[model samples]
Target: MIRIENLRKTYGKIQALCGIDLHVPAGELFAYLGPNGAGKTTSIRILTGLTRLSAGAAALNGHDIAAQSTAAKRQCGLVPQHVNLDSELTVGENLDLHGRLFGMPAATRRQRIAELLAYVELGDRVHSLVKQLSGGLKRRVMIARALLHNPRILFLDEPTVGLDPAIRRRIWSLIKQIQQQGTTIFLTTHYIEEAEFLADRVAFLDSGRIVAVDSPTALMAGVGHWAVDWVSDAGLQSAYFPSREAAQAAGAARHNGFTLRRVNLEDAFLTLTGKKVATDANAQTVHGQGHGAHAAATRNPTGGQAKKGH
Candidate 1:
C-alpha cells in the first residue's frame, strides 16, 4: 500500500537519505531496519508526510505524498516513538478528542475508542489519566489514539523499544492482530529479532541507501551457502558446506563441528552494513554524535514518541 521510488532527503551538508526505493504491499508488515544514522526514520517521516523529500516520488495507496498529502495521510495511522498524549486528559478522553479531530462523530468515536482500548489491552485503564499510565500503557494509548481514525495503513516506529519482555510480547501480539485484520503495517526498528519475528519482508538500510530488501529467508540465503567462522585471536577456523556431497567433493578442505546452519537477518544486516551490533546497554554515543542532549535531539526521529500525527 506504500510505494517509494528514488526518495532522497538531505539536511544542509548531510545527506540523511539517499534514494530509498521501497514497496510495501497491502496487508503486509514490512520492517525497515538500520543502526544509528542509517536514515530509517528519515524514510519513515517522508512516508508519513511529516518530512518533505528532496527528490523522487512517494505514494500511499497510489496517492502521491507531495501532491495529495492530506488524502494520503488520512489513509494511514502513526504511532510515534515518543509520548505525545496530553498528560491532563484521561485515556478515553484523549482518544475521543483525536477521533473528533479526524472528523469522526461522537457515537463512532466512542465505539472505536472502546474497540481500540480493548485491542491494545488497555480497556480497564481508559478512565485513568495518561500521566498515571505505565510507559507500556501509554504506548498502547498512543496506538489507540492513532487508530481513532481507522487508517488503512499503520506506521509504527520502534513500537517495542523500552518495554519489558512481557509488555513487548503483548504489543507484538497486538500488532499481529492488527495485521491479521488487514492493516498494512510499515515499521522502522533497530531490533533485528523484531523484524525476523513480525515482518513479511525486511529491508536493510545503511548510510542512507537500501543495501538489501527481501524476505528474511531470501535475504539470508543471498548472503552465501558457505558458513565460515574464525575464533577470536586463536586462529581457529572452520567452513561448513551446505550439503554432504559438496563437503565430500572439497575433501580435506572441509572441517568438523561446522554444521549447515542458515544465516539469519542479523547476519545479513551485519554483512551488508559492516557494523557490529550495538550490544552495550550504556554505549550511547552513535555515529560521532555524543551521548548527550545534542545526540538525543539529532537522533533518529523514531527514537521515542515525539508527535501524534502530521
Candidate 2:
C-alpha cells in the first residue's frame, strides 16, 4: 500500500512534481504512465527516499516517508531504470551484498540468495560475473536482489526497457508472478502495452501532474473500442468509434486510405494529453537530470545522498 497527497517537488524554478495525489491499495499492480519529464521518476525517487519532496506527504504502508523514513523504506524494494549492479561481482555475490546492507544475518543472506536466484531462474548463473550475463539476465538478477529483503512493496521503474520483445515478455511473466504472490507493485514505464497488459490500474501523468487514473480497460473504453487511422496533412490522425462496424464505415468514408485497429492505452493517453507516451525516449526532467543521477542516489538502498532536481 502506498499513499501520496499533494506531493510537490521543485528544483530552482523547475517543478518536477506538481501536487499529485495518488493512493495504491494493498496487493494492487499500479502503473504510473507518462512521457519523459512528466515527473514519474521524480515521484518514485521521493517515495523511495532517494529524492526529497518540496512539499506534501507520502507514506508506505502506514508510515510517513518523511517522519518514519526507516519504517516506510523497510516496506519497499526498488529496481531502478538502469542496471546498477556491480559488474565485477558474481550474481550470488551481488545479492549477498544487498542482503547484508539490509542487515540480514549471514545464513539468512545465503538462503535468500539461493532462493531468489532459483525464483528468478538464475540458479545456474549464480557463479557467473554480472558483466558476463545478458541484459535480460541482469534485469532478472536486479529483481532478485530487490526482493532479497522481502519488502512488501516493489517499485519498478522501466523494468523492461531495452530488452527484446521475447525477453520483455519473460520479464512481464516474472512481474505478474510477483504480484500474484501478494506484493503491492508500483510501476513506471515507457511501454504502454506493458502497463496495459500488467497493471490493474494506471495513472496518466503529464506536465508534472496526474491527468487521469483508472483501469486500462476503462480508460480505453472512454476513448471508444475501435480506431480508424488515416494519414493527413497533419501527419497521422485517428478517429475512435464504439464498434468495429462504425469504425469500418468511418474508414470507408475517408478520402484517403485508412487502417482500422483496436484502441489501446496509448490512444487513451493521447486523447487525454495530446502527447504520446513513448515520445522522447531519452528526454530528461525539466531540471535536465537523467536516471544516472538517480541510480547513484539509490545504489545504497538503506541510505544515500541524492542531488537535488532528480
Candidate 3:
C-alpha cells in the first residue's frame, strides 16, 4: 500500500534520489539494494516523515506522506541501520515509550507490550535493561518496538547487519512471520543472500537511480544461473554461465584460485552497475568515500552535510 511518483531528493549539488517511482502492494516484501550513496536512507527518511522530500509525491496506505504527514507516518514503522533504542530503559519501557509517542492508551499499550515481547521471543527480557541484551536480542527489541503501534508497513534498514549468521537467520524467520501476518515490509540490506531469501521483489539503486527491479529469481536469471570467478593478473573477474556444465567448463579453463557458485543478487548488481555492495567484513572505498555494505549516506536533504558510518 505504498505509491511514489518522481520522488527526488537533492542536497546542494548532489542528487540523492533521482526521480524514483515505485509501488508496493499490500503485504509484499520489497528489498531495496544499492552501493553506498545511492539514496536508500534518504528515501526512507522521507517516507517515515523524518525528512521532507525535495519534490514529487508519495502516499502510504492512500495518505500523502508530505501533505498528510501524521497519518502517513502512522502507517509505517522503521527499524534503522544502527540500533537507536534507549540503552538505559528496560525492554518493556522502551516499547512503552514508543507506543506512548503514537498516543496509544495505557491499557492498549500494556497489552501490545506483552504480545509484542512474546512475538519477538523477548518475554523474559521484558524487565531486562536494553544494554544487557545481546546484539540479536537488542535487534529483536527494536523490531518489537517498531511493531508496538501496529503500523501497516515495516521499514527495516539492514535489520541483521552485524549479527552472527545463526542469529541473523532467526531474525529472518521473525521477519517472515511478520510478513505472513500481513505487514508490508520494506527491507534494505547489503547481504544479497538475505534479499534472495526474504524479498518477493527487489530493486537495485545505483547513483541515485534505479537500475533494475524484479523478483530475485528473475534478476538472478537475467544474469545467468551460475557464476565462476578467478584471480587474474588484471584483478578479480567473474563470468556468468547458464548451467552447471558451462560453469564447470569455465572453471576448467581457469588455472588458479577458481571458484564457481550459483549466481546471486550481488552478481546481478555487479552486472548492472559494475559496483559491489559494501558490508561490515571489509571496507571498500570508491573515490574517497567508504560505502560499507550497511553504510547509508545520511546527508541532509536540504544541506550538504552527509554523515556516513557502518
Candidate No. with top TM-score: 2
TM-scores for all candidates: the values are 0.81, 0.89, 0.88
Clashes of each: 6, 0, 3
Report the lDDT tens digits of candidate 3 across residue range 1-310: 9898999999998889999999999999999988667888888888998888999999999999988998998999999988998999999889999999999999999999999999988898899999999989999999999999999999998899888778988999999999999999999877777788899999999987889999999999999997776555565567999997898787777666455667778789989998877542322222113112233433234322222322
What lDDT does the true structure give each of the candidates?
Answer: 0.75, 0.86, 0.83
lDDT of 2 at 178: 96
* Positional deviation of residue 174's Cα in model 2 after best superposition, in angstroms: 0.3
Model 3 misplaced stretches (Cα beyond 4 Å): 279-310
Q: Put down candidate 2 lDDT per residue, 1-310, tens digits, no spaces.
A: 9999999999999989999999999999999999988999999999999999999999999999999999998899999999999999999889988998899999999999999999999999999999999999999999999999999999999999888778988999999999999999999987777888899999999989999999999999999998776655665578899998998798888765666667887789999999988743322221123112222221112222222111
Instruction: Predict model 1's lDDT versus the native.
Output: 0.75
Worst ten in a row by lDDT for model 1? 301-310
Residue 176 displacement in candidate 3 (angstroms): 0.3
Candidate 2 local accuracy as lDDT? Answer: 0.86
Residue pairs whose backbone atoms clash in candidate 1: 81-304, 81-305, 82-304, 82-305, 82-306, 83-305
lDDT score, candidate 1, position 44 = 77
Preferred candidate (TM-score higher): 1 or 2: 2
Best candidate according to lDDT: 2
